[model samples]
Target: MNYQWYPGHMTKARRMMQENIKLIDLIIEVVDARIPLSSRNPDIDELGKNKARMILLNKSDLADERENEKWQEYFTQKGFHVVKMNAKSGAGVKNVLPVIMEACKEKIERDKQRGIKNRPIRAMVVGIPNVGKSTFINAFAGKACAKTGNKPGVTKGKQWIRINKNVELLDTPGILWPKFEDQSVGAKLAMIGSMNDQILNLEELSLELLGYLHKCYEGILAQRYELEESEDRLAMLSAVAKNRNCLKKGNELDYAKASNILLEEFRNGKIGRITLEQA
Candidate 1:
């Protein structure tokens, strides 16, 4: 299967970010805890080069707990103030303000010396689609300030929201680069439902997902579907189909229904707290 990310309005989003970067003092980047590095757009590093940076590992609740800690350490070692959070439930939300203050402490001190007081820190929130940028903003602000959906490209334009008297947020649409340098990254993004499902070949994608789960997380399928052992990924998917009662008119397995179930369960953490990559 070819893992292609349709660019959509990403080019325009990049332009908007470039135009607004200078007006920003800090960047609050959100990434999926399951695919931290893959979910990150490389353009952000260039766009936010001179600014203070923070990495919010959104949806950390759905990822492997041990891996989440490692990801926090990994990003911290690279000079980003990191927070592991679940934006939907607002878990770990309270930790954000203190860390934001710490990340922008230098700028705050500089402003104090320049006779500026109570100047809110302007931060640009960024991430690839479906990494939960809008949800994070809503949770952080304790209100529905930005629109959020399960799939990608929900946010279409920029919105500036005051998170507090000390910090304000600039919300930008999620953007992915035109081409994925590693096709695996694209595949991972697709598995996480970051891409539009209408254009994808779900059966092929489910097979790939089955292969990964059988390798990295053995017994997961057996436990979830109560299936006997099968080395073949397609066979495992068939078992999922039978277990899910996804049968067609002729009693043949509905691979498409099984595929959707597998992918959706994986995304929603029903398969377990699994991480796609290691730090």
Candidate 2:
């Protein structure tokens, strides 16, 4: 399935980000741990150019541990203050403040030299849709200042949240580009629940996911559904439908139901700690 989702509100969101980018001192970008690169909006890099960058690898618990480490190193090498965090459970959330200080160290030093004391770091939190920007904000602030949802497009507008005396956060809506240059990036984003599921073909998407799991994580489906593993993705999905009793009124295997189950399980990490993209 060809994946593309750019809601009309995103244009306004992009404009808002551009207008506010100049006022921010640091760019605190949240990205999905399972698909770090794909979950990022390329526009953020341009918008945050020459700004202090801190990357929170949100939902780290759902991603492959080894791959998460590799991605951390990758972003670190690229000069991002990286932290692995599961925002839902607040795991590794305590590390954010210190790293924020670290990322904006020069600014703090300059402020101190100018006799400016306790100048709070102004950070713009950005990410692609459903990458946990609001959840991270809530976790970092230790309060629910923004709305949180399992689906994408939760934050409709920007909200300034005072995190602490040391930090003030500008929380913006998650933004995707006008078009994906590489469709694979779109597909990966869709699989991670960044795209609207209502507009997607789940069965086709599931086949693609099944193909990957069978190739990289063989025997996982068999273990989860108690069915024989197969190189054929369609056969495996069918088996999953039958084994899980996903059926229509006439006892026909319901591939749609099976597809939703598989995607939901994978998205929730019930299948395993799998990374759609490797660093």
Candidate 3:
């Protein structure tokens, strides 16, 4: 799966992010827990340089626990405050508040020293689409928060949601473009449902996913779809089709319908909390 991203959109997103960076104290970057490295935008390093940074390994509920720990350590070693979370369910979200304050401790102390007291730490949530930014905000703020509407010169209608006395978050998440030049990166994103479904070959993607599950997870396919363990990837796909009764008008196996079933099941966690990538 290859993505054709226009440079014009990239330029605009970059420009908008640069402008927003100046008005915030911390950058809350959300990345898919399954492919933490691949899901991240490389340009974030440049854009967030000299700013306090925190990495939320969102959707941690669906990722492998061991891989999640490794990814947390990986990003922390690189000077990013890392937290593993299930943004949809708000699991591991409460831990984020303390981490957020810790990430911006220096800035908070600076403000205190200059006699600027009672000011909440300003934060902006940013990530590529479908990484669950809106869900996170909604979960974090609940129903008690107020939207501070329209700051001058900061995009005419941008609203800020006061998370608490100590933290205020920008209501809108900054959109970042993924690095789609790497074919593996694109494939991983597509497997995780971040890419557009119309352009993908479902059968091909399902086969690739099956190959990964057989190699990394082992016996997952056998347990889920009641298939014989085999080294051949296509054989496993065929077995899945056969078990699920995916067939055509002439009683031929319908590989495409089976492929859709496989991918959808994986996405909805019917395949059982499988993560596509590891450390």
Cα-based TM-score, every candidate = 0.98, 0.98, 0.89
Q: Rate the local accuracy (lDDT) of all candidates.
A: 0.93, 0.93, 0.78
Instruction: Kindly report the root-mean-square deviation of model 1 from the true structure over all alpha carbons.
Output: 0.9
In model 3, pairs of residues that clash are: none
Worst 10 contiguous positions by lDDT, candidate 3? 148-157
Task: Estimate candidate 3's alpha-carbon lDDT, on a 0 to 1 scale.
Answer: 0.78
List, residue by residue over 184-273, the lDDT tens digit for candidate 2: 898889898999999999999999999988888888888898878777889999998998799999998999999999999999999999
Give the per-residue lDDT digits (tens) of candidate 1, residues 26-121: 999999999999999998999988799999999999999999999999999999999999999999999999999999999999999999999999
Each prediction's total of clashing residue pairs, residues at least 3 apart in sequence or on different chains, is 0, 0, 0
TM-score of 2: 0.98
lDDT of model 1 at position 68? 98
Candidate 1 matches the true fold with a TM-score of 0.98
Model 3: how far residue 158 lies from native, Å:
5.2
